[model samples]
Target: MAADRLSALPDDLLQHILSFAPEREAAASAVLSRRWRTLWRRESALDLDIRPYMAADEGQDLRNSPSPLDALLSDAVAALAAFPRRGGGTVLKRLTLFLDLNDVDSSYDSVDDPEPVDDGRVAGLLADPAAAGLEEVLIGCEHGRMRTTTYGLPLASMACAATLRVLELESCNFEPPLSPRRAFPCLTELRLRHCFFKEGCLQAMVDAAPALTSLSLDRVSQQPPDSAFQAMPAYCWVPFRLRCLTATTLELKTYSVGAEEEDLARIGIELDMPSLRYFRYTGDAIKLSLASPAPGLSSVDLNASLRGEQSQWEPTSRMLVSFSSTRALKLHVNCMNDIIYGEEEHGGAILPTFPNLKLLELDEFFEYTSSSAALAMARLLRSCPVMSELRLNLNMTRWYRDDEPKTNDPARSPFAQSMDRFNRLASMTASSRRVSELPAVLTDDGAFTCLQTSLRKVTLQFNANELDCFQVQLAKFLVENAMVLEEMHVDDGNTFWLDHLCNKLERWRADSFRRRNLTDTARFRVHHLE
Candidate 1:
């Protein structure tokens, strides 16, 4: 520039601009000149990513070794201490600390072999007086097989709780106080993932964080209730028993739900968040009692191992009734028995119509490929009177219907051995063809009538199983009835086949008329078979 515009600004403005840079870059700016050397030190936030420690030690097969994180911790503490205070007060507000034990995205080890944190880095950070002004702390510790059990939770109210507004803890043991009466007075968002807690500890934390508006617990392990606590009542040990919380959004996933095979103690749930708007759960089929219906709840996701037993399926019935006002419903079921459809004993109960539901998703976990499966899928679609979009994910080498979209990642590539064989054997001169069971979904003109459907866009992914009656009929029905249909995607699962199934589609169909009309549709794209 003609007059050095950046240097023309005041010192305060220069320091503010440097604060936006990464911590390392902020420090490096000092090498530019004497003017920038001291500007980086005035930043209010300390975002530290301590990953190089473990990255350097990778493939060494080190176990139970002293944590390399200790040095980084000391550096953070020193930085916090060094940040100058005006009028004898701290200015630190945000501290995002990510302590990764191993490289999850590019890990060579099959097992999660994490090095233990033997240093006093974490404790020093929490206890430091300079952190009194910290309002947000996103601290995560991921060890392959280690947790900070000895330290428990460094969350005493006296330490930064009064000033903390957002707290996220991962892989940390949470021990509850006798009665959490005055804790996290200003906290609003709390997330605990892969954390260990005693029976009463979770409830105690919820009771303390009265101002919480959002809460998420992923893979949270709740220990068996103590003998003294077990005798109290069933609700005492419940994982998500939030009687006092008025949070509007909640996501909870349990690690242990006692079934036949596991030796884990039985876990119960009782949710009473009247203001909850979004609810997501992933766990075994342990029954949960809803204290009241979330009138404002618009989205729900239920991932469970629903079996033939009534106990597991019964809760789903209650959830359907409770989430009647929900606009979107997603079900990720492990076991797809008739019981999951509320067929046996719970079918008689009149389930409310999902009047607001317009989008439905079936998880890839469902492997049922039959007429009954179609009916089961239609049952949900029928309940949602105005459903516009439906996404299906087929997990078992075909027909994938799910609540969430699968990303384009090599790790998630669906390249199976069967696909390889199908590719090599498949050609314009077909050798062997196997037909799949035809599902008479539309034959019964009662519950599911595609002619009167409100579907606008449909995306289906399935393994090309002979492209038989079921697949053809389903495709034809969608092209005809979906008057408002915008786009249709038919994906074939043959990721890395020596010979592609798509290349042999013309030969396999045989009938020229069928082949010509089959691909013809409104905004249709048969995804290339990889």
Candidate 2:
């Protein structure tokens, strides 16, 4: 080569290559070539994570660590100060700063009013004029046990909110901007997890962000908005704005076991998302309500926990019908059977039929083998009209669709209704039921409808240590009932021990059966109990 290929590239291209790389890898790039040495310093993003290093050394306690002007804070401050002051080619586009706190006074002063956080070095960087072009910023911290701690970050210190596109803060308290000014205009995405806002600042920031497209409020504080704020005006209808929201992705998780549930009122009681595509909720099922039908939703994950008294809560399957249009759903609840079957724990309200569901995951699936569980499960199986894939957590049982169709049992009467159609010759004396009896039952029987589709896969979780009759029966039932199954993958998760035992049992059976016959020429085939 006439010249080195790396040295021939312009400075701008090299800076981009370094900008996209991780902070550690970018530091290592200096050894590649002399020209690439200083290019990392000129990159557009500065993502510095010093938490691991600090956690490893374990030498400096929070009360005794070097001041923000001396340690990790100083490095961040210096990096911002030296970030290219030339004719303006590449400015700071993104900044991510992560820190860990081992104690309450982790190198920052403790205050009671605004927040308990202290980072003078970050404040110093924000005050510098070089940070005026910053577009995105994420400041996250980790406490010992994820305990709530408010960080004192003055909005006035950050002068780049007008240009900021994404802002995410965790374990901190954020104060709104001062009066006689607008707030975060170009912001598109905002994620607040375990963060606190000053009085009235929460609603003010929501009203000010004119271009927000994605918002996630996971366990956000329940503090009421301030009645008097010098910087922002009031909205008479805040819930309506949330109902008519246009964001594409929204995640809401609430943990109301603390005093906030008793003191603070619930905000945004009904979700009015029309443009939502993905959703996840993980706490307190009794708190959610649908403002209108969410026709655009496609994915949902519900980690439901019942709080307060079950008698006071209306366990209506109707609330979940809003998500009938979803393509995938993961449900983790202890009382799901109660909702599906409308038992004594929950009112006897049958869930509506879902015509668009494809993949359904029922967490704690092995618990559905008891009389109550089986009855509830039968009801659920009869409601998913178009479901194709079902994931269950099976702990070694030979249970199948028809293993114990307890038609005589009062609890299993709903299932007997579906099985009756398959065995209609035994039930109806006229050879066929009247025309009207067919539609009301067949049109609503999901188990009968599932057999008509292209259900080809049955995946089960089992164990080698506890093989039972249900394991074999489930496979037989799927092969016979599904009618079009092509694959049945069982993940025993114990390294094929069950398969080994099945082989040993099969060999033993064959030997014992062959010994019983007087003739050695007699051919024998043996089936294992497993």
What TM value does model 2 have?
0.69
lDDT tens digits, residue span 1-530, model 2: 37777677898888877776657678788898777777786788877776645655476675766643246667777777777653357688887877664443543332223245555455556656777788887877775553555556667678677798998877666666686376778988988877666555665676677677688886665343454422222211112124435666777776544323322213324676767778887665443566666777778887765555554333435446667677777777655443553355445544667777777776643332443444444555566667777765544223532353333345756556446434533444442321111122222445556655645455555442222333333443444345444444555432223233324432433443456562322232222222
The best candidate by lDDT is: 1
Number of the predicted model whose TM-score against the real structure is largest = 1
Residue-wise C-alpha lDDT for candidate 1, range 229-323, written one tens digit per residue: 44332222234455644898888886544343232223356788888888888876555556887778878887766545544434454446667
lDDT of each: 0.59, 0.57
Each prediction's TM-score versus the true structure? 0.71, 0.69
